[model samples]
Target: MANTMTSYTDAQIMKALLTKDFSGIGREFVDDVITSVKVGAFTGAQNLDKVSLPSVKEVHYCAFQNAAITTLDLPWGELEAIGFSAFAGASGLPQNPVFSKLTALSNGAFAGTSDKKNTDLRTISLPLWTGSSFSEGSGFSNSTGGIFAYCTALTSVSAPELQSLPTQMLYYCQALEEVVFPKVSTVNSGAFNYCSNLKKIDLGGAITRLGSAFMANASKVTALILRGVTTVPTLGSTTFNSTAVKSGNCYVYVPKALEATFKVASNWSTYASQIRAIEDYPDICGS
Candidate 1:
């Protein structure tokens, strides 16, 4: 199936989207990598090299569920949101969902946070994605763990705009080594559950809440940095029970001025001995 030139109008794209039929869009290219192409509503069967959606504001659910395009050119300047499962499947997209342009995502466009469960034939399903790496996912404010959950190959995350971590955000991503959330204040339930390789977290002063099992099974984390937080943030049950403590050296960093406050703050008292003041160490997030 070689697609030479059958340009589709925006109306045709929407029509194909509404009807879920993409016969009008010339299907497939032998190279499987496009230099530059513009259109929408790709049937999961097509192989594309590049896709550029310039005028699109919203990508409805499952629009490009399984197109084998190697490049994704989302209309970052104009796109507002992407519905759930908009790009599901292990190979649906060539890269991770690190939207480098979601600063304009003002209306809370979640981008269809997909899981590993959907069995629809429209999207290609496979085992774990081993090549995925984590970067600063920009332009998104989703509060669901579906963003990068279950990616066995994910190693690090550096989301500067994230103020809160959604439930099960990185659940079971055992390869995670570092997480840098400069502004994250809230951590929902099961946020980092079962991530065995996570070594450190630098939660700058803005943190306020830690939900249950947020770091449930992350056993190798040796450091937890909260050097900027003055007040003891709220803690849920077993926040770091089997996860960090299993390493026997999980150090919790806090401001020296308020070290006493964190030591006795309800559930925090459980790790009172592990708490240390950030003022005492310059290279804290690592140690």
Candidate 2:
């Protein structure tokens, strides 16, 4: 095929979508022509990409399993919510859903909250995401496991605008390596559970609650930096788990004035032997 671009009527697109056929569509379609997409419409197509619907305001329950979509660009200004498993099995996808202008998302819209059946894509970089929480019942809670539980290739997450994290958001992502959440203040349990490759984390001071946030059995963490947070959040029994102490290389750095406070807190005090003041480690910020 020439991979050409052409016009498609709403009726024609709807027909192909309902039949699970893309034989009449092109690799790139114009968004201005598409107004709506039905639930489970594009479930198993193999060659879809570049769906430009600048006028579309919402997309309800759709699937794109094993599709060739690379670099998604949605009409963020009008997009309200995306329903379950929109990109469930697209293993080739290298980046997370890019909600450039949209603000809201629904349950299981990106990946399953409990099972590994729908999430084969890797990486979750919500660059423009700015919210305290996500729709809980939407994805993460419906499944028996975490949202990224089966995303074995997933390696990084960068959500700078978010202040809090959902529970088990990245559970069992064994290959995960780097995380950058500079604005996050709170995190739910098992948020980073079983992320074996993660090495370091840089969290902001607004943090007030933590629920087994960074528990792991094979953790490779060596540096943990908390910037200016005063009152320690509620720490889970396994929040630090095996990461709190390493041979002699691991260090937890807090504000210069609050080192004493951290060393005396309940769960945090358990790692007091490894905790230190930020001034003690001038290189904590990697300046």
Which candidate should be chosen as best, given TM-score against the real structure?
2
lDDT of all the models against the reference? Answer: 0.56, 0.59
- The weakest ten consecutive residues by lDDT in model 2 span 136-145
* Candidate 1 ranges beyond 4 A from true positions: 1-25, 28-52, 66-79, 90-92, 96-100, 104-143
- List the candidate 2 regions with Cα displacement exceeding 4 Å: 1-12, 24-31, 46-58, 65-81, 91-98, 106-125, 132-156, 242-249
Model 1, residue 131: C-alpha shift (Å): 26
Candidate 1 residue-wise lDDT, 1-287, digit = tens: 22234445556545544554445544322222232222224546343555655445555444455555555665443444454345544143433344443432211112222344222111111122211222214543332445445656665555666666667767766667888776677777887787788888787646777788788788888888885575778886666667765345788888788898888989888888988888787676544
Q: Which whole-number lDDT from 0 to 100 does residue 262 have in model 2? A: 82
Alpha-carbon RMSD of each model:
8.4, 5.1
Cα lDDT tens digits, model 2, 1-287, are 11123556667666666665555676545555455555555576545555555566556554454445544555544555554455555433434444555444443344533344434456565566554223335434222124455466677766678776666666666777667678888766777776677777677748887666454553676777777487766776666656635344567777878888888898777778888877777775553
